[model samples]
Target: MSKHPKPNALIWLILSVVVIALDQWSKAWVLRDLPEYTAIPVIEGFWNWYRTYNTGAAFSFLSDAGGWQIWFFTGLAVGISGLLTFWLSRAARGDWRQALPYSLVVGGALGNVIDRLMHGHVIDFIQWHWRDHYWPAFNLADSAIVAGAVGIALFGLFDGKRSKKA
Candidate 1:
């Protein structure tokens, strides 16, 4: 009988823990130190540390849906995180390309879920602007989610091409 090395990427979950810790810590700092709705310029004419809250998804989508969105979004994030975690458990230890993105997304999703369950909304602070036009405020969790998503898409595309070539 030949022995097999079942090295799974569960170790990558450490990155998820780090992301959650940072996201929660920054949100706590924002709540303690920042003034709500006031923009404090971090980079003159470009970025600001703006405290805000969102009850909905990105860009405040369905934020005013009469409080039901809290459960909706919370459930959705939890489900997605669970799915990604399952994927991580199946991924190979050497497959950082898949493991990394899954970990990031799981961390980001759970981070926001914590806020939703505790405060009924997600805390946001980082803000970007172009002259007078400003972008919707978001937090580190959102950043991780976006980065992970982009990595998944871009890397998956490249991997597909490589697979076809081989």
Candidate 2:
């Protein structure tokens, strides 16, 4: 069988860069135009702009660990991003099913790492709520990460089934 052309991982890196740029830009905008802990209603009862900071992992897991969580999370994200980059480089170039999700994950990880370096925390500005209950605030990086994860899961399921049939 003829060999498939090598995947060009650079395209995925470019996508990662775009994600990082958008993530940082949105965070900057929130920082400049919004106040901390204050919620501004964007919808009747579903969404709001609530500027906040997360110094730890999701749901502030280690936020109260006395500042060590900052470096820990930063290091963790950097390490993960590096590994994902390496994985992307080895992935088949024509398989966007693999590249896009990996790139997004790398971008989102790096975006939050930058926040840890620059501000000691991740800036979150988007909130979803109903009545008196509210979800944790999140930012673009978080959104990208979630989207990428979902993509990866969906792709994995479909690809696995396809391979079984082959």
Best candidate, TM-score-wise? 1
Q: Where is the poorest 10-residue window by lDDT in model 2?
A: 4-13
lDDT string, candidate 2, 1-166, tens digits: 9997675675778988999999999998998999889889999799999999999888878988999999999888889888888888788777789889988988998999999999999998999999999888888888888888899999999999999999
Query: Cα deviation in Å at residue 64, candidate 1?
Result: 0.4
Question: Which residue pairs does candidate 2 place in steric collision?
Answer: 7-93
Candidate 1 clashing pairs, residues 3+ apart or interchain: none
Q: What's model 2's overall lDDT?
A: 0.89
> Model 2 compared with the native: what TM-score?
0.93
lDDT of 1 by residue, 1-166 (tens): 9988698999999999999999999999999999999999999999999999999999999999999999999999999998998888899988999999989999999999999999999999999999989999999999999999999999999999999999
Residue 166 in model 1: lDDT = 100
Error of 1 at 24 (Å): 0.4
Compute each candidate's TM-score over C-alphas. 0.97, 0.93
